[model samples]
Target chain A: MWYIAAMALSIGFGLSLAALAGAFGQSRAVSSALEGMARQPEAAGQIQTAMIIGLAFIESLVIYVLVIAFLLNGKIPAVDTIAAVMEKAH
Target chain B: MSLELPGWLAVAEEVFIGYFGPSYHESEAVFHAALVIPLLLLFVFLSTRRLEKIPTGLQNFAELLVELLSKFCTSLIGPHGLAFLPLIGALFLYIFTMNMFGLIPGFKSPTSNVNVTCSLALVTFVATHYYGFRYQGMGYLKHFAGEPLWLAPLMFPIHIVGELARPLSLTLRLYGNIMGEDTAIAVFIGMGIGAGYLPFQFPMMALAVFTSFVQAMIFALLSSIYISGATTVHEHHAAHGEEHGHGAHGAAQAPAHA
Candidate 1:
């Protein structure tokens, strides 16, 4: 039971942190890009394209955490396995 | 309470297994990868036959997609980017198709499998280097060397690691997105059965399709950006000439327009 809880917590905390960082990074990137475009409307096309690519790179870092979680997720104790262990304990 | 389930739901688990190997992981993603080819062939044949001066059917749709894809590539990579239309277009269409396929009740997206995504990423990796070497010849290796000569040792490994991370990032991005979408949809449907209530599927499927497009666009766009980076010198020179022309026009028009 302790093992399962730890596993769940790590995955939850891991992704939450990742998403937090990613969201902040993306908003900053877009905000900066918007500021640039607002100052130079002629450069809006270039800024928009660069913004999309920058946002993807930022998002991918978060996805990397999810990938690690996915690999670890398989190792989590299944409910059936835990139930069987409880029955054996009783 | 017993409920009726769609016949297709029953067959959803079935997929044609690939004969390529022992079917490592015994997963059917391999078969789906193989299946994309014949599907494309059939689609192309059906859509392109009997071209008319004015297309009225699938041909029109096909032409429109081609135009849109080429325009997208040109915008990102510039004029010379048209030369990369075939590679960019195929990657976009294939990734998009594989992604959307998962939304079908009985179909699985091959991209949900890491192996399939790795193969896709490998192509991008190889192309990035191949064009880099082709464009810059021996100078391509210079990119690996850090800006200052003394930093070569530190920068070389860093560059190599960063380069290697590109494919891993591409693979993980698509695989995780599609796999997560597939899992969410499956789990929701399974819940409907378990809770004895109709699954709240409409929103899930809609989100799946939407994310599928987003993922595909990201993959294709990144691939083009990598290719453009690989051939930077050529594009840089070309853009220089175009910029001069544009500058002259802007100067000439600023007074008249303003």
Candidate 2:
């Protein structure tokens, strides 16, 4: 029971932190790219491509955390198992 | 997790199991991947059947796709990149089509599966190293040796690890994104069913369309960047530094008007 709770908590906390970091990193990248584009309108195309790639890289890091959360989620007991445990305890 | 739509292939699997006494099972991802190949082949064949100086209909669309892909290849990997048009173009089409397949009510994205994405990433991995060796010969090994020569010991292992991580990261990135998107849509759809089929997943489906295109382009772009990095000669790197730049910065700046 404790194990399951810990896993769930870790997954939630880990994902939240990852999402927070990813949002900050992506926003920074987009803002910098937008500034660059504004400064040199002719180079907007290049800036946009760079920004997208940077976003992907940052997004991938968050996805890594997501994958880990998924793996942890799998370790949690299924509903049927949990129900069986409760019945046995009672 | 419990509520999910059945893809066409899943329905077929059910029929097959009924006939074959539960002994036969086929993966939906495999079926979808197979379906995509024949569809792409047919499209290409039809589009190229009657080429003209002044294109029309499917021919025009085909030319546009080819032109865009060609420009993408050349812009990233230089003039010689045209040689890889077939590989990169096929990958772009295959991945894009598979990604879009999930949006269809009776279809699922093959790329949402790790096996499919792993195989695709492995192809890029193999091709990158192959082109590296073919173009740079034994000097390709020097890539791991790092610059300044004395840092070989520290850099060699790091480079090898980085090289290995590329395909792993590629596999996970594509698989995770598509799978997450598909799962989100499925969950929303399940919720909608409880809510009297309210089309709750509509927004997600719309977002999937944009993400599908962006993911496909990113995969192709990253593949081209890897290939160009591997194929570029050591001296050429310095020579083209001003014109082409290097790494992501160079690739970003390559096609100013693109």
Which candidate ranks first by DockQ, i.e. highest?
2
Instruction: TM-score chain B for all models.
Output: 0.80, 0.89
Task: State the TM-score for model 1.
Answer: 0.82
| CA RMSD per model (angstroms) | 7.2, 2.8
Q: What docking grade applies to model 2?
A: medium
DockQ of all models, two decimals each = 0.39, 0.49
Docking class of 1: acceptable
Off by more than 4 A, model 1: A34-42, B1-25, B234-258
For model 1, residues B1-258, the per-residue Cα lDDT tens digits are 011122232343334344334434345677667778899879899988888899988999999999999988777665667888999999999999989887776667888888999999999999989988997898777667744658889978877887898899899999888887787787788887788878677689999988998899989888877776666553353335333111112222222211
In candidate 1, list every pair of residues with a backbone clash.
none
lDDT by residue for model 2 (B1-258), tens:
222477875677677766644523347788788989999999999999988999999999999999999988987777788999998998899999999999999888999888999999999999999998999899888777765568889978887888898898888999888888898899999899999989999999999999889888889988887888788775664445443323444446545424
For each candidate, give its TM-score against the true structure. 0.82, 0.91
Question: What is the alpha-carbon interface RMSD for each candidate?
Answer: 11.4, 2.9
* lDDT value for model 2: 0.83
Q: Residue by residue across A5-82, what tens digits does model 2's lDDT show?
A: 888899899999999999999999998988899899987866776687778889999989887777787778789999
Model 1 residue B43 CA deviation (Å) reads 2.0
